[model samples]
Target: MEISVFSIQKSKADNFENEIKEYIKMSSKFAKISDLTIFNEKIAKAQSAGSESALKSYDDIYEPNLKGFCIALDEKGEKLDSIQFAKILESNSQISFFIGGAYGLSQNFKQKVDKIISLSPLTMAHKIAKLVLFEQIFRALCINANHPYHK
Candidate 1:
């Protein structure tokens, strides 16, 4: 499987950056990572852009290359266990995840995705959201492989 993360922004904190990098490195063991595209959150929010419009702009940018299953990460989305998410990873050869900006994902984008899931019930900074998503993905891969990392 090939997993791709389309994130709104990169983490500026050094520690968070390092952790994300480590998770990315660890994830290579599970699936082929095609791309980790980070769009500038500031640019995404610029010039009177609402969440809906900004998200649509991104949809245009990444939607074409996207194939197979797609998922959106949002606060209001479903909460899945590692086992369940592992099934999703196993089923799709090309899976793409849409991570929102600081303001979060738009309603239109939420509705357009094949599935929607939430990392946590509490609101988080978008950068942290990216980290959590990456970790969960790694955990899911571990679970699928019967590896010890899931625990």
Candidate 2:
């Protein structure tokens, strides 16, 4: 399986970098995983313009990547347990997870994706959110393989 996490954030050194890499390394045992951080002048400019503009920019950037079982992480989306998340992985060989920018994903973008899930209702920094998502992905892969790590 190949898993890709696409998040709208500036790529830089972060405190969570080491742990995030560890999860990716661990998950490598199960699937090929890549973390793609996207941030350009257009996105930056739109962010300062306002929430609606920022969301539109997010949708414009992320729309092209919506393929092969896409899932968007949004606060208003459905809340799923680990087992349920694992069930999603069971049937798909390729999965792409979209994490929006400061204003979150737009309604149009959410509708374009196959599924939308909320990691938490509370807001979190992008780095922390990425770390949590990586960990859950590792756990879900373990569950699918019956590797005992999920327990």
Candidate 3:
């Protein structure tokens, strides 16, 4: 199965970018995967401002590029544990996961996705979210392969 991660911001810190790349490399060892595609938010500011230009920019970019089974990360989404997530990953025919900008995904974007998944109830920084998500994907791969690392 092909998995893609769509995010709204670029990696700002060198350390975080390196860590993300490390996980991506580890994940690729198990199976071929694409780099996290980062989309530039038009506003380049926090979402609370709700700039029209940003909303329009997102509409033009996010949906059209997202294909296959789309999953949006939202606080209100169904919460799943690591093992269940592994099952989901193993069973998926194709998947695309979206991490919204600081303002979060728009209502229209939310409607287009197949499902909403919450990584945590507490709000997380986008950078941390990316790292944690990649780690979880790696763990899921380990579980699928029955690797000792999972234990």
Give me the candidate number with maximum lDDT. Answer: 2
The better candidate by TM-score, 2 or 3, is: 2
**What are the per-residue Cα lDDT tens digits for candidate 3 across 1-151?**
6778878775565527777778778888676656565555444543445655566566566878678778898888999999998888887767888887766788888898888999999999888888888888889888998987687
In model 2, what lDDT does residue 137 have?
Answer: 98
lDDT of 2 at 106: 91
Q: What overall lDDT goes with each candidate model?
A: 0.75, 0.91, 0.77
Ranking by lDDT: 2, 3, 1
Report the poorest 10 consecutive residues by lDDT, candidate 3. 39-48
Error (Å) of candidate 1 at residue 21 is 1.6
RMSD of each: 2.6, 1.1, 2.4
Per-residue lDDT of candidate 1, residues 52-99 (tens digit): 566666666556645678898888889988888889998888899987
Q: By TM-score, is 1 or 3 better? A: 3
Q: What 10-residue stretch in candidate 2 is worst by lDDT? A: 9-18
Candidate 1, residue 52: the lDDT equals 57
Clashes of each: 0, 0, 1
lDDT of 2 by residue, 1-151 (tens): 9999999987658738789889999999899999888999999999999998999999989998887899999878899999999999989999999998999899888888999999998888888888899999999999999998977
Q: Alpha carbon lDDT of residue 19, candidate 1?
A: 82
Q: Give me the displacement of residue 67 in model 1, in angstroms.
A: 2.2
Error of 3 at 147 (Å): 1.2
Report the number of the highest-TM-score candidate.
Answer: 2
